[model samples]
Target: MYYTLHQLQIFLKISELQSITRASEELHLTQPAVSIQLKNFQDQFPIPLTEVVGRQLFITDFGKEIARAAEKIINQVEEINYKTMAYQGNLSGRLKISVVSTGKYVMPYFMADFMTENKGVDLIMDVTNKSKVVRSLELNEVDFALVSVLPEKLKVDTVELMPNKLFYVSNYDRKFPKAVSKKYLFEKIPLIYREPGSATRNAMESFIEKNNYSVHKKIELTSNEAVKQAVISGLGCSIMPLIGNKNALKNNELKIIPVRGLPITTTWNLIWLKSKNLSPVAVAFLNYLKDRKEGIIQKKFSWIEDFINV
Candidate 1:
């Protein structure tokens, strides 16, 4: 019953990716090498870690428990290494961040700049839904979670980063008036909505309920990109975040309709569990964000006036 931390890491990567090939690609190892390592790691435990069904891999409940423990071990080792490195006055460590889907457009810029400045820092970023991001924060799985709507139940420390604005968008060919009334929006236009549980969908629903209005959902899509494509294809209009649709709007693939009371504005926030121990890298990144907050605002959202005033 012997397994190296490296093997545990390989197993965790495979579990995360759910594919040997993908894990191999991410780890820079060949498929066969990854498979051998996974097998060796699994042999150390009596219970099956993973199961293959119809060419797809899935981690069992036991495997999930093992992964949880493995993550803690990995974090502990990383913390020890970084603490030692800190004594040497080196800024070399890993920063794990989980960001909501919409943050994909802006977070890379932050990561790129941070990584460029601290060449020894490794960044592990997960772009996921708000629910998953919240879950990660609750589990202390990441150093920080970036999201628009902070969960009310979680005991978290949050810093507002920027604004997240949802605009009513449609194909440019629709030719709707720039400023239509809310009544006209609900009655005259069919809506293409995101699937249930999405932050955008939930926010829009809450807004509708608060305003005592009902909008028809003619189409439902899982992702923002899908909703944008549906609008581009003339399926129906959707309330979308302007963060990810910059290119689309710029190219006239989708136009922001000037609906009255449009652009439901929300604030982007960086949240982390207050109970979790903050690593040096996490502290550094938080400080970096604070120091560069103004620059981030100007760089990421300088064009907001164009949309807000449209």
Candidate 2:
């Protein structure tokens, strides 16, 4: 027979007070009624639960065993209540995020700040390239991904967080033809670029194709930093994020190629599986992003345009 919650509670109250009169008084039941419920439970099992001592009632061995186990249950129940209260009062849980290599530079700041307010929460991240991140999300390997591009057929949804303006840059000494033109962008200078499937590479190609231009040669540099280094060495010019090149620009180690119709702008965006429901931690982090000043993605990144203009 399935025991009811009411039966379990009655059993626990009797175990605590250890007397039918006391338990009955506390539970507002007649003593005989309390005795009947307890006796019914005991009879369902093998326990008799009663032993008559001289002028007193005492519990039998099996009854004491059940009582101790019930006490443990009661302790655990109390602990659960306390934890529930705490959880409702503040955000608490683990947040596992996957980010594109570039997002590793910015996304973590929000994660860090969110964890500070909700100190008990855990933040874990898988940092990978754009392709691997999408793969991981499709396989349900991460809570969400921070990405620059979202593929059309990928089982994912995206929020355009901020515009990631792609610009052409070259070493201070790598002088190009008269005041950057379409042919100069496409044909004259070699491109220090990312891997073939990179969003930056795709966007750059789209711009090139749309403008009716073609690159004579490109020197594929796999990383933004590496591309920056290559451009700094006068190897070639490259398209990269304004944030990525801000410091280099400030130091005059590089200069944005003065190309008209340059900076192929795309969103440095957030992506997630459209079918996956976000867990509490992930939702709270996203809401937290919408709450704070630096937490808000697009508005906080105004310095991007400033970096380009400066």
Candidate 3:
């Protein structure tokens, strides 16, 4: 192919943002320059890489495949650069991480600390639902993934981070007696669930199943923010991770629906594919987590401890 890796990188960025303008802004290039490079790159493919519809840019199926290849090439090149830097005793390169939407609450602190200490490290964090995070790890698109639950089927290395305690919560206006039973919660309250395949939803379902209780799932939402909004609007109650809902809980916008044996506890784990050759930066991060796990969690998650019994 006549296209340069620089052009391929731009193409991948455009595919991600689906806007040449946004890609150009991120790449520090002018829009016309980005468009020109994109057009030139697309010309090399027999089929069009993208289509413009209603002023919106959409990557064609062919474009997606090409973008995937571009992603691989970019990662390999980054790996080589990172390895070379490692030989020279430099810790400078990009680190890609995929995090479950809920992990957004905690990861920024860790990222900030790491980046502050290592000025040359660039971190890319994709905040998505559990399924996409797993897919990214499977594709080796990210160096690591921050998740609450580990998939048993994928051969991976995991380091336990901290407890991810889940709570049954509802709008502050919703009435909950001082104490209630699982039966009362199941029969009285409507359950708002995260989308299917979500780790939070799965954990809630597993709790119900383990306790031999039936739940009334009334609403399904795509994101944690959506679920919180739905609950706050008095649509229904939801089982959610306490880490993400600390502010809402502290402000009394949302309240715990206290029941017997409440706050089902899960764990947060940092995972990576076992077989993949991890870069030096990735190894350094793992080591950082291992060596400073307690201080990091205590410093970042200490606010949560006052509210929940961690």
lDDT of each: 0.84, 0.73, 0.86
RMSD versus native structure for model 1: 3.5
Off by over 4 Å in 1: 1-8, 28-84, 177-181
Best by lDDT: 3
Which residue window of length 10 is worst by lDDT in model 1? 175-184
Q: Give the lowest summed-lDDT range of ten residues in model 3.
A: 175-184
Candidate 1, residues 135-237, lDDT tens digits: the string is: 8888888989888888999989988887889988889788666666777776578888777757999888877777887775467888888888888888888
lDDT of 1 at 71: 90
Could you give candidate 3's per-residue lDDT for residues 26-62 as a string of tens digits?
9999999999999999899899999999999999999
lDDT for model 2, please: 0.73
TM-score of candidate 1 versus the correct structure, residues matched by position? 0.81
TM-score (C-alpha) between model 2 and the true structure: 0.66
On TM-score, the leading prediction is 1
Model 3 lDDT at residue 263: 87
For every candidate in turn, the CA RMSD to the true structure comes to 3.5, 18.8, 3.9
- The clash count for each model shown is 0, 0, 0
Global local distance difference test of model 3: 0.86
